[model samples]
Target: MVAQRSPVDLTDRRALLARQPDDPTVLAEAQRLKEVALLDFGIRDSVVASWLYTKCHHHIPTTAVETAAVVATGDGSCLLLYNPQFFVDIGLAGVRFVLFHEARHLMHRHLYAEQELRADPLFHLAAEVSINHVAMVRLQVTGLPSRVVPGKDAGTSHEPVGVDPREVHQRYADDLRDQGREPLSYEEFVDTDLVVYRELKRMRTPLVMPVGLCIHADHVGRHGSEFPADAETVGLIIGEALAEAIRAALRGNRLARDEVLNLIDRSEGGGDRLTRMWGNLGAAALRGETPRTRRVDWWKRWLADTLASKLREGERLVYPKKQGAVLLALGHDPMLSRRGRERTKVVLIALDTSGSMPDEVVDWVTTLVGQTDGVESHWLSFDGVVMPFVPGERVYGGGGTNFQNVVDYAEGRLAIDGVPFEVQPDAVIMVTDGYAPHVTPAQPDRWIWLITNGGDDWPEHHHPPMACHRVTTGDR
Candidate 1:
């Protein structure tokens, strides 16, 4: 049992309207509790939850709800709404469970948004049961979280209000057995949120009443005018947090990877956007297999996304065609000139032509750079010398690979076809077998290396490391 303040004291309707906490002591206590829980999450390998909490605004609003929740702020952000007295009532352990539970709820919302499922009370209960189960296992807590009894003394009347998956499964088994139907085994029953919902819905008698108390179980007017948040805004905020978590995991954070894989597994029910985003962005790398069968390889998708980010790093201004038309209509000079000449990004692609390079790799690179809207691509094949070549044109090199020669030409120390390399490339992509000695580029940050199979990735180990990945060819 955990100690908590009595909710009976704030039962009056007028008190709910006071959005801000008047007492500094109560506010400080709540903040202290949240900080401790956050620390615990960091130490316990709950990276996604911890990261999400850090990105959100923690608000101690005087609301009628007893527990905390993650809600949107009407803007393009989210906040964790908690009650100070509720935080003080639940001990540190309980606070941790509640906070984690709320964070998981936000993730669940982002993963599943089907209207039919949202409308199903049984499905909502299933979500609560599933989330609470994960929380208990991850937090290593044997007992379910207890809610503060409204009319009782501070610590004497705590009741277990958290949903128990085993209990629900048993009830489901009994109901299905009575109707001469077979119930799924315990393992299958609690496999995932959507799976649990499907099993629960198969029961002869629907669980009309909720087994325990869950704030989300009551979907009626819960986030009314009191909380000015919409599902879409909150979903976007959580999505951004999830993306950051994935990036951290890809950067070799073991704890972060564990949490992200767990999240990706649970969000298996999301639609195409989720599938494409999760599949292409390191999920396959983390799971050791691509998420789904697709025509485009995961590494190719990764390269395209990486290139987009590097090329779109700087700012560019558009003329705003509508603005010019309006100005001309007002009898003023339209001034329809380009505002930013930096719109066209310059990119250099250097292919190592010493050995037989994969045609598929070159073709893919050509398609990506060609399809891009505003780009000026410089193609070159280098062996002992750098030779400027056009896309789809066969350029051969046989003697030996020299990375320094390519670098010299790119940095203007050497000339190709009597043309000085005047412009600074926004991005330089090097595709090679990685057999040559490594040379540092003038702007190492602007370089991306794609090493062939069984090739050295020395650039990744270089100081101030550049972007690097191993390109897998189907028929090399």
Candidate 2:
């Protein structure tokens, strides 16, 4: 069973608060230490450190807590809590390490956000190990000096505190080797948060996490347990901060750049979430050799442009009769006019419901089309048959392809339950694998074909070329 720390008692908290010094000198020194840490962060990893400072509010609340911690305020901002006495005890290097450690915890929280993963004891241990390891390496510190207790001897042995990633890896390696299994290298052992958890779970006897080490550990009755509602927003903020650090590093911030790049290198296993976030953030510095900073997916950009163009309102200006008096006074012709266009564009989206279509593509397309404004969407999931669906409704099918059924429905030749499709759609977007025979639509110019991978694309080679673009699945 995992060891848990008892919650801070109210009486003890009150006592601790009462003993906290109100001396100007001590408070001033605490503020100076915080500033010094920030300056050091700017010198080491300029962009991210600066970004973190802006998002987090620093407080030196009187508490019995030994070290510093970071907690979310339920708003977009975070709190960096420290005890002035603790700072005095750990010295300047420890202060820097603790500050960096807390910042990394926030970063870890932003990255590995799945609730299942967060609840795992092993995963929590792995995260602490990884964060501490990164903090030690970046700050050039081997170990944290143990905090002094009031009743403890002054000259007692100063054992290093907190979990060490290397030690944890060694434990796993020894356990695996004794079981006649191959061991992963230290680098591979702690590669990702999930990897660490998975490997540790495989062991019959995994190392137990010590209590009172990780401040963010989700034990019962923990203080400052509230997390923000907008995790994506927090993640984006962190990403933007990392991006700024990368830019600063490129512009001659050597120490800052190196630190930022090292952190990025260590964070390799975040999968597509990390890739999509970092890919567009001018991450050439992270790659070391690649000078091509930004790498955005072309298809997404194209799709955005297409959607914008299609949804744009056709413009025509007219003078209102009420403004005629003002216009005449300004020596303009008194012509009561107005600007207007057709009602919301009716878009028929036909999904080829053959078993070959990817579900992810379908979901993405549906969400995109559904969310668009000034457009009335009519969804149809078709195989050899066509079935009409309302927005936010599920479409289930497994049949052969039939493009004619979609056209017939859009052209009002077919009716469902005695209700004909009376509205002539302004645009018809058909998402298909392009394996079936293609029939000419009634409005060929308004037809947009999004062909999937490895599917036959006949429209591209048709006698009169139509609006055809490959719909990228992004699976590759």
| 223-306 per-residue lDDT for model 2 (tens digits) | 533322246545655765675566556545777578677766766666666655555554642455423234444345444445
Model 1: residues with Cα > 4 Å off, grouped in runs: 1-18, 57-61, 110-112, 208-212, 219-231, 269-274, 291-433, 438-467, 471-476
By TM-score, the best candidate is 1
My TM-score estimates for the predictions, one after another, are: 0.63, 0.53
TM-score between candidate 1 and the true structure = 0.63
Worst 10 residues of 2 by lDDT: 220-229
User: In each prediction, how many residue pairs overlap at the backbone (N, C-alpha, C within less than 3 A)?
Assistant: 3, 3
Each model's lDDT comes to: 0.72, 0.65
Give a tens-digit lDDT track for model 1, residues 1-476. 11233232232234444654678787777776776677667556487787677666444456456577665656666666677777777767888888888788777772345778766777777887688888887788887767568878955788775787778889999999998999999877877888888888888788754432555454223323222347777767776667656766766788778888887877676678778767645575687766554555545766786787677533212235687579769984333122343478888999999888888889889999998879999999999888898986879898788999878878888876688788888889999988888889989978889888788888888887888888873321
- In model 2, the runs with Cα more than 4 Å from the true position are 1-28, 45-47, 64-66, 110-112, 155-157, 218-233, 285-476
lDDT value for model 2? 0.65
